[model samples]
Target: MFRFFESLIDPYPGAVPETPPRRLLAFLFHYSRPLLPLLLAMTFFAAMVSVVEVMFFAFMGELVDWLAEAKRERFFADHGGRLLGMAALALVAFPLLVLCKSLVTHQSLFGNYPMRVRWLAHRYLLEQSLPFFQDEFAGRVSQKVMQTALAIRETVVKLMDVFVYVVVYFTGALVLVGRSEPWLMAPLLVWLLGYLVLMRVFVPRLKLISMAQADARAHMTGRIVDSYTNIQTLKLFAHTQAEQAYARGAMDGFMETVHRQMRLVTQLTVSLQTLNSLLLVTMAGFAILSWHQSLISLGAIAVAIGLVMRLRMMSDWILWEVAGLFENLGTLQDGINTIAQAQAVSDSPKAQELSVPQGEIRFDKVTFSYEAGPRGMDDGNHAARQANVFDNLSLTLRPGERVGLVGASGAGKSTLVNLLLRFFDIGDGRILIDGQDIATVTQASLRRHIGMVTQDTSLLHRSIRDNIRYGRPEASEEEIIEAARRAHADTFIRQASDPQGRTGYDAHVGERGVKLSGGQRQRIAIARVLLKDAPILVLDEATSALDSEVEAAIQEQFYALMEGKTVIAIAHRLSTIAMLDRLVVMDQGRIIESGTHQELLELGGTYAGLWQRQSGGFLGLEAAADAAPIGAAEGQTRGEGEASVPDRQRQ
Candidate 1:
């Protein structure tokens, strides 16, 4: 009995060898444990309601028989009063019992159960890592969570009601039929056999249909979400028609699957109804034959017919509920699979908390690669080469030293920054801060000492003040403004206003700060980083998106702000890093040159070649102009010396 109940409740157990299909029941039991008492109360009430319903049916049958036998006055005189009183009490009791059951079921199942399950699932989803969101479409995830909760709730409630009622109706009908005419039991057994055989043939098909429907829905949801998120891109490219066609294709596929499943269900339901009707006819025929042979009384025939009808209704309801249960089980399984796949990252039990420290970074021969292959990769390319983004890269930054990194595109510059931030752990070697290996420290703690401003600045759709304060949540308004002033952001911020005429810092930055210009956004990002005031700073093409005039202005401010801070700046523009204390040139994931600007120029190596190519046009012309002036000035000074005595007399 306990195992049966457990199976009904929890559907999924642990991932163990030889686990059964009933594991879904195990999941329900696990989640429902807290609601066990309420469930028990609901179950008790449900059983009482079922019992009353069966009793009501029996009582009605007896009342009909009593009316039919009204000619026997002596029989009525002996038991008429007792029968009337009992019938009256049953009529009242049955409805009262049903009312109580309804209240209890509504309170326990409809109200509390869904709320608790949703809360638990939502909390669990929230705890998942960043990769989970990356892999799933937001619409699909939202749909799954909401529909799964609703499906579970409906399945549980209906299962409870159907199981209890079926048991009571079947048991009561069987006993009554056996007492009146035992031969009726044989037909009941036949009916049960037919129902089971029909279910065996149709249930698997229903599950398949449901699974296919759910897959289609998820695909449609994903397509819709993708289109909505990239709507601006579609509009910019004038691909509105193409996007609409793609969405139409998804919807058409979904509708086709839904129609196919609905047709199948219709056929199955019609066949089941026909079979039930035939069983009813057969039962009625047998009961009439038994009455004619005097094997059963008229009252017994009435009772038998009532029992058969009740049994038929019970069977139909149970079959339909079971079918729905199978359908819901498939949906629940999909949700569970999503959740299981989402648990990709888990912190080690022995992982240690990182103590805050001064900025001192070291990378010791780090190698890293992203996941590859069709299943692992987001892109659907099975033949693509699985290559490492970085290989055996080693570098060190002493406390308070500012270094610049120059690299071409796909040279692992961003990968290096990501590694330093511990977004992804290295495949080999170790990264350390202040002599402590990064892996040993908590991720939150390790990030606390680092401040970064990347090329693509993403600000929340919020007030400018809030976006600035996001860098340091506890920062005061004055401190934020000060940081803004330092990053040269205050002048533009003061000129800005929202649609409502709220000026300066209170202006709304549209989604991803779209309302602001690229330069303004970059400066705001810089201000955010300045407010953070971390010991280590990483600037990855921080000024690349700005125009030259704005870039020059920000660059001048950046130099002053970078003082006394350890900085790692990655940029493709070599001229920007010309003033750095040291520049490191990287190629194919390795540093090829590291030296001062003048020393690298003297070597005339890759760095020098790049520098000359970038600055040759302007610097060469300026040098020639300055050389001509130096020679003329020298000749003038020599002429003055040769004629100095005569020039003094003339004056």
Candidate 2:
């Protein structure tokens, strides 16, 4: 029972496979079971309405026979008041029955029932892991959810309506016609066989067409969303014409698919119409022959004709309804595929919560590679290349140790930080915090203890105060203001204004904080980190976006903020980490050197060369003269720096 419920919740378990059409119907039934009572009620009403329609037609046949017999007498009297009353009753009862059926159908199918199902499905989708979003486009996912819900609702309601009516009406009409003159039903049976064959032949094609149309629509929507998201990039690169052409091409493909499906539907309708006309003519000829041979009365002929008409109409209606059901089923099937295919990140079944600790971090033989290489790429070809971001690398940081990491671009700086935060699991080794393996801890609880500020600052479209408070949702207004002051953002928040001259921390930041300047956004991000006040802090070129003047002003406050915290700073600019007690210089994902700024300079290796290149020109002639290498002094004279210099100088 438990396993069945689990399967119901996750219909496509294990890597999502292609679900057969029947599986989609099963999923709908499982989810919509809660509304079964309403569904059954609607079905009952629909059956009753159909029966009433057949009875009304039968009554019309009776009325025609009565009029034929009473040529000179009062028509109502000749038939007696009972017949008149029945006709009158049908006039009132049919409408009442239809009204009741419509009421139930609308409430159950269009109102709360489907909406509740959609709400639950949407909630479950939102609970999916980040990898799901990584693998799918946001707009496409949303479109699938919405369109699937609507398709399911529409298809279910239509299937219910058609199923009930066709069964009840066709069964009743067939019985009546067979009793009146059994030969009349022969044609209908043949028609039913032909109809089944037609569906078998064409339904698969319709399903394929529907699936193709859905894919085209999703592709067009994804393209539009991508273009809008990168509108700035498009304009900057002067690719407007190219983007427009791409969008038009996608739209054209979508329209072509839609038109092809429409053509198929048209062909189906024409074929069905011709078949229906032939059946009508054949049945009429049979009725005429039977009447001429005196095998059936005129009244019986009337009844048979009425029954044949009902059967023909019901057959066409049912066929069309079934076609629509299949098309919608195709759409629903695609949506199910999307949701099922969403890649879920591996998670432990019994993950433990992260306990508060003293923030000691250790990386033991950690190695990571973002991509698996091609089969033929040799080890030496790879080995001489830069190592995997972290190849058999190890590090340890005690509680409250402020360490700085210096490395060139592509030297595993950000990768190290990402590992510490457990964004991605280490490939070969364990990352432990206070001796607890990170993989054992709950991801949410583990991240709550760490705070970060990156070079690219991002803020939500919300009030400045709210953005700051996002770091710690329960923080009081006073606490937020204090954090802002520490990050030097309070002054800017006070000066910030929206239109109409309103100014304060309550001012709204535009989407992704685009309304704010880079410096202002950085300060706000820093304020968020301060507000979080986590035990471990990671600054990955955090202040690099700010100008030198702003950086200098914030560094003093940053030092004060760093007290009693475990800090890891990664920077390319050596000057940023010059004041740290210890500096670790990395090359090709391996730490090649570690020491204080002065100690590294004295070693006169990679660090010394980097320092010389940065400070050599800025210090001017006298400073350069004092620092000239032993053999280069005769060639490089002081105060002759500019006069004797060539057009190009290499550092």
Candidate 3:
């Protein structure tokens, strides 16, 4: 019993696999089995209560008939003691049944089941690959998870409620009353057939509209969160009205779908009410006629009327229950559609933990396209023609070599690094670390061997101390402070203060380190990497945010940190890479020039031309394309900068 509740805590408790069509049933039953015994108890006791309800009407009829003075005194004398005992037993049982139902219901519905389902579903979602998240909104995904769990609880509860009552009450009513006037039961039979037909026609339509409304609601939520997350951008663009209009468009879609659903509900209610009214009137009229004809007792007429009224009330309640069930069904279908997807890339069944002895990296005859065009289009035919990010590019980094990759935007520099990190599996050829194929190793183990610092440094919304410790969770405080000092982050960290009354390592950096400056975030990132101290290091525009003076000061520490580590540095600033062992310049994803900075300049090749145009030893996107020809500006010194690309050339 304890294990059953424990099972709920881990949403992904190694569920058996199911086919797509059976997924909904499998999802429901997976979490419901634990409560099977309770559900059965609830169903049995609850059904007996309906039987008691039917008896109550019969009791009322019997009491009324006995008071009429026709065989009244003798009937009481013969059966009064037994009758009183039965009434006392019923009075005790009614509240007992209701109490049992309430206690079981509270545990099953309002206890931990819904939240457990939610936790499990969300945990399953967390296992989906990066691309899956990239394709949808975080807010929408979270919303779907919540809806799916609630739907599970509501769907089960209502199914049991409606099914139990409809079967037990209807069957009991038919058996008890039909024995006397069997012909009068025809209206109820007709009502049953009509109700079935109505549900069959209207339920699907209700489900469709409900699904649309859920989607619209999710989309609206995503849009509003998108705006909140980028509030600064909206403020900078001065587009408050534009944002409102965008949000209004989503709201309109949501409102339209909801209105359509409500209209269907109203129509169904009126139609069901009319059918119920006809059933009530027909049963009452037939009972009066039967009594007048001397075919049944006066008590039977009252009993018939009471049963008809009870059936009317039950039918009305059941209709709304079915409607609520349908609404939740639509939500469940939507949730399953989003949450259930085949994982794009996962660790191979036989993949092993990576053991990096010496991280000598190599790209062996590699070729890859992003599987979509630059514009993110994926027309089936066009995918085959997608332009390659890298083609037949081969490179080797000897252990502990510090080599720099210099390239313009879109030249596949990041793609190469991304592939090495196994963020995306390669299309062809192999990326090897220590001669071990990356694809054959678990991603967690593979990534642990490499440390990276990119241009856009994002930090968690946590204290500076925690963020730095994130790199190496078990690192001693002394080591953490040492890393910060090496990365030159300790001084500003100690002096910095914000409106939140926090300073230094204890201060909270807002989401993506929004509370800190560009340089501050970069230094924290650098400290993190320093704390990590992986065998392989990648610096993609690592010092781009630092001014020249700071860059010069930090370069000494960076070089010291890079010693004896296999380093792959990418920088647009010429001076940053000028002192590296070799400069491998690329254009269009192919190596154009390679050698030391002086050696390449002496060669008077593309690198030489580019060297002359660099400003403050840095190359910007516009300048890289419009660099003067070799020796064109020999008299002019560096830092004058190249002009922007010609419009025709850019086109």
Candidate 4:
């Protein structure tokens, strides 16, 4: 039975709106559509429960009058059937209705509703473009996703329950009072008006404060998470005090918002208690005066006082319910800021799967700038935005060609690779793999045909085997080990174990592979990419962390891995790429020189000068010197740097 209720709604709905509504009511209605019928059934049961309680009160008044006016011998004869029927309802039917409401609520809606909401919200977040994540703290974004789900569930379900019960219960009370003496309804009506007035004044103020509180909490969480993620850097720099101070600033902001919210809550409590006291006093006085004037029965006076006392108790509960509703609504609004935005990047409706046979790559006059704003929006900011990373830049690699990229920092080397991967859509022009434009192909398919290894490799906190198999899920165990061996990663992996004693491939890597050395992490990353075996490969300072012996050991394997693939390699250690088929030297986002290493050396251009500046196989340039054009120097004839290459190579 429990499982039956849990399965009533699919937790992961197949279809969802691309953009969620921002307005509270619309947002609630949108997510609630699947649960609406069950929710309405619950509301009906709540209303019936309210009606039963009111009937019980009326029955009590009737019984009081019956005992006073009837003889003891004839009491059962006069009211026996009705009394027995009411007893049965109280014992059986009333409990059943309450049970039905509870089942729909606790057993079904409460759990499934939030889970469904979170699933959809998480899906929407996954669809967001790379820049969206780059712009926000990861921890804060996840917190909003989690908080919004619970807040929406609490706001909708509790508000529904409270609203239905109050309305039905109040209406029944008013009718019971009016039947005794229509004038007796005055106090009840006045009390209700004052209650609404209080809600009107206090609820909006609570909502605003709650929203501020939610934002502050998220900000504080983001700061702490940032510190933790960079804990190694903190420890290395010995800045524990500075880290604490940085986190404290966010903590103080959060406390200020919390203080404001508590102040409003205190004020609201005092005002509500005062109003409830007046209602109880006024209703009791009126009931007694009506009975003295002979305008109402003893039973009517009893019912009036009873109803007023019950309301007095309920008013406090109602106050809290209304306050919590607005507070959750405020939280929902904060969540909406993260979850309701439309996807900045999405596949075109008619996009096709990318197919790469020859692995030919082309950049046809591509132009791009990160400063163009997300979604490539062009506004007044465009005029003041930073210069384009690539402007009318064009490059191509023939099938199975191996080329190296040589440039200083900010020379557009990485940006060019990012554009080819379609991490950001180009501001103009097109990138094609083979003949199909990348923009016209599904992103998943485009990425599947390319494999890349970066200097700053990050691994999932999963088993070594699982991380390697991630490149191809169906790969067998033998294949995984072989790939690791080729990447020369198998030696240390055999010795690897987590604190849990799980050894070798089964052992878990710590967060972001922090348990592993930089070289070990890079080797695992290389192994994974090797398993992927894509037709196109990119290496961006891929071996920067390895010691000379290990680097030399893997150099042959890397050459083999590059066979029959179009490769683009980037390295500060120019020697690693100097032996490739060709070298392309970029400066200020344009390809300034391109040729074989020997040819470029013969040209005595930018590439030759950069080669001349290398020490121990790595670019050794001072900050200011790298900025200036390093073309052939004055008083040095062509091939002057080329003639000295052998001597430096021997060093």
Candidate 5:
């Protein structure tokens, strides 16, 4: 009962697995466990109602025959009182059980199970490793969560309402018809066999169409959401019509499936009607013939007629019920395909909370490769790919050391950071913080000791206060304000007000902070990291969004934030890392040089060449390694500079 009630409002307080449910029946059982008993009890009550209905129809038929009898005077004297008593019993029981069924139907349909399914799906999906979300469409995933729950609810309710009633009512018809005239049983048996055959032929076709429809619907939603997320790109390129056509294509496929499925349904109805008419005519004719021969009474003919007519009504209803069942089942199958996925990274069984005292970071011969295929499994030739990233990389940072990592794109700079965070496990390596291998510590606890500011910031669709406070959710207002001030974000935050009339720190930032400028978003990110105030800090082009003046202004704050902290800063802009304690230069996944800014210049190696190519504070290593300084031409076109060896090289 608790599971059922909980399922209505939220997924039961049990762990949701990260993989697709093993099978549909088992999956439904787990989610619908709480409602099972109630549903069964409801089914029983519905069956009783069907029994009452059959009895009522039988009594009415008998009463009609009794009224039409030639020996009416004799019948009234013999059986009139008992007939009236049975009639009264049927009258009271029919409506009473109907009222009970209605109450149960109301509860089951509106009990909030859909809401719970959505919540559970979202919660479990968010818990999946980052790659999973990256691979799926946000809108499509969202659509499936919604579609699955509704489909399940409709399917369950309809099963009890239509299916349970059909079984009991059909049985009642067979028994009543058999007792009335044994010859009439032949028609019922034939119709039953025909119905089973019809389902076997049509149900599989409906399931296929339903699956197709679900896929097309999800695709359509994903296309629309993709367009919306990139609305600016469409407007800028004037491609709104093209995107619309793309979405229309998906809709066209959906419409086509619906057309085909509806045609099948039309055929099904025609077939069912044919069978129903035959059953009705055959049974009624047989009953009349038997009665004419005096082999059965007129009451038996009337009862046979009632059962055949009842069967006709039920057969018509069953056509739709079966169609709906397959439709919903297909939807659930589709939803499960997208919603359940295996986790690439998960916490170890014995992982413990990290204790960061001095914040020393060590990379112990760390090596990794980009995944060869889905699930990050290496198919073959994985060693070739592995060699391209890091073979036996080793690095260590002392407490309070500030290290700058300079590298060309794909030079393993960001991969180093990824390894530290354990976003993906290493192929063969250990990253330790304060002597604790990061892999040995719980991800949540390891992350607690480190704060990061990435180049592309993604803020939640929330207020400025909440985004800032995200760094330290429990931080007081004063602390939040202080962090914002330190990040040079207080000025803009105070000046801003959203359309909803929320001003200052309370102002809403639209999705991914679309309402704010790139610089503003970067500052908010900085404020978040500052508020975090972790022992270890990572800055990946952290101030790339700021102008030269703003960057200079915040340089003081950045220094202050780095005080007594172990910092790993990645900068395409060479100037940002000049003041760090040491500079590490990497190329082709190996650290080529490690020294102070001045020492690297004196070495006249790869570091010296990159420094000379530095134009407008950026190291342009990708454009032309030998080209004369292009910074003056394009304000830092990728890695172009003429190196007239510096005086520092001689020093």
Candidate 6:
């Protein structure tokens, strides 16, 4: 029965949740609509349980009066049947109702509701644009996702279990007291009004405090996780003290919010206790006076006292539930702010799947700027206020063409590659793949045809086989091994063993492949991309991490991989790209020169100047400063100063 209830709702529903409403009730209703039937059943059982509880008190009153008046001999004949029937109802029906309620609340709603909330929320978050993640703390965003799920579950389940039951029980108690003697209802009526007034005053204040508390907790978590994520950097820099101070700032802020929340809770508790005392004293006095006046029976007096005492205990429980409800609501609101955002880089309404049969990429008069930020907003003149990474910049990679991008840091080399991958949308003009506008195509399909290996590679915390096969999930073990071998990663992988004693392909990689060396991670990344075998390949300093010997060996494999694919390679090592079909020199968001390595060297232009300044196959820092401009209008090269290669070698 527990298992049946547990499996009643799908934990990971495929349907996307609708835009969450800002209003608390609306948000609750939106998520609750799917499980409305079960929730309704749970509420019914809860109310029935409350009703049975009230009937028990009513029966107790009747039994007290009967025992006082009935003859001892006839008592069994007269009231035994009634007492036995009540016992059967209490033992059988009441326990069954309570069991059903508990099953739904604990087994079904507790587990499944939060899982669904997280699944839907996580799915929505995945669709958010890259910049959305870049702008926020990964730890904080994740904290919100997790916290929101539990909060929503607690809020809903508590409402069904505690709030609904309390309301029905209280209403029944009021009716029971009034039927016993009209005077008995007055004290309860006054107490109910005062209880509501106190709640109205304290609950809202608690809610506001809870919001601050939740936000503070997430911020503290983010700060701590940030420190942990960059622990190596902190240790290398010997900045442990500084890191502690940074985290301590967030912790102190969280403590302040906690203090404020607890202060409010203390006040609410004191106020509620006072209200409870007045109700108990007033009900007792009224019950005693009614019995003295002979206006109510002895049993009526007993019932009134019993009901009021139960309410006193219940009031405290209700107060806690109500306070918690609002607190969770605050957390839900905080989570919604992070998770319920519109997608910034969604495809067009009529988006089509991109097909790249020819592997031709064209940047047609493209313009882009990271300065205008993710939303692409700018002040005043669009061009004047913004510093563009690319402005009216156009380049093309012909089908199966091997092109290299040469530039210094901040010269838009990586930016151009990012643009090609559509990681960031361009400001003006369109990028097309084989005559189809990239913006009009679905992002997944567009990326499906492109394989890229970045300089900074991060691997998932999974086994070696899993990370390698991520590029092509359906690839067989033999194919994976083959790909690893081609990338020269097989030897290390074969020798690898994690702390858990899993060796070779089964060995787990630590977070972000931290367990592996830089070269090893790069090799694994290369193996994955090789397995992917996309038609359009991008290599951004792909071989930068490997030693000369490994690089030389991998060069042949890269050549094989580049065959029949339109390849764009970015490299600061001039000699590595010296043999490419074309090298485009970029500076300050504009292309200054473009030709084959020999052609550019013969032409004696910026590329030639950069080539001449190479120190041990890598461009010197001085080359970046000196190779800024070309007298292209006059068709003349900049003068090669004393900072040239021969001068540097002698120095």
Best by TM-score: 4
Considering TM-score, which of the candidate structures 1 and 6 is the better prediction for this target? 6
- lDDT, each prediction: 0.72, 0.72, 0.77, 0.85, 0.79, 0.84
Please write out the lDDT profile of model 5 over residues 1-651, one tens digit for every residue.
434443443334456444447488766765667667667767888889888878877786677677777485698687769777886776776677876676665554345666656667777777676666666678898999889988887788778767888888888877886876788889899999999989999988999999999988998898889888877679999998899898899889889998999999899989999999988888877888898888887777888888788778878778778878889999989987877665567777898999988989999887665443223366677554423356679999999999999866655677688778877777776788989988788888988889999888889999999999999999999999999998899999999999999999999999889899899999999999999999999999999999888888788998999999999999988899988999998755678789999999999877777788778777776564445222123222111111111210110
Pairs clashing in candidate 5?
Answer: 4-34, 620-639, 621-639
Residue lDDT tens for model 4, 439-546: 899988988999999888889989999999988889999999999999899989999999999999999988888889999999999899999999999999989999
Q: After superposition, how far is residue 108 of candidate 4 from its true place, in Å?
A: 1.7
Per-prediction tally of clashes: 16, 0, 2, 0, 3, 0
Candidate 6 worst ten-residue window by lDDT: 642-651
Q: What are the per-residue Cα lDDT tens digits for candidate 6 across 149-262?
A: 899888887887788899899999999989988888999999999999988999998999899999999999999989987777899999999999999999999999888888
Per-residue lDDT tens digits of candidate 1, residues 1-651?
333333333323332211112357766664666566656677777787767666666666666766777667677786689687777767787677766666656644575566656666776666455546766787888778776777777767666666766777678777777887898777788888888888898887888777777767987998897887766678899998999898899899899888987887788788888877877888899889998898977777787777777666666678878788888877777766664343433344577776545667889888665543112334655345335555677899888888988654444566677777776656677888888888777667667778899887878888899999988999998999998988788999999998877889999987778788778998999999889988888998798778787777778778877887889997767777778888887655667789998999998776676666455222232233233322223334223321222211110
Model 4: per-residue Cα lDDT at residue 17 = 48
Poorest lDDT segment (10 consecutive residues) of candidate 3: 642-651
Q: Comparing candidate 2 with candidate 6, which one achieves the higher TM-score?
A: 6
Q: What's each prediction's TM-score? A: 0.78, 0.79, 0.85, 0.94, 0.88, 0.93
> How would the candidate models be sorted by TM-score, starting from the highest?
4, 6, 5, 3, 2, 1
> Candidate 5 regions off by >4 Å?
1-20, 69-96, 99-105, 108-110, 155-161, 372-388, 625-651
Give me the displacement of residue 9 in model 6, in angstroms. 0.4
Better of 5 and 6 by TM-score: 6
Tally clashing residue pairs in candidate 6: 0
Candidate 3 C-alpha lDDT tens digits along 140-181 = 888888888888888887778558967888887887678778
Task: Give the poorly placed runs of model 1, Cα more than 4 Å off.
Answer: 1-30, 68-105, 108-133, 154-161, 297-299, 307-316, 372-385, 459-469, 474-528, 548-564, 615-651
Candidate 1 displacement at residue 284 in angstroms: 2.3
Instruction: Give residue 497's error in model 3 in angstroms.
Output: 6.6
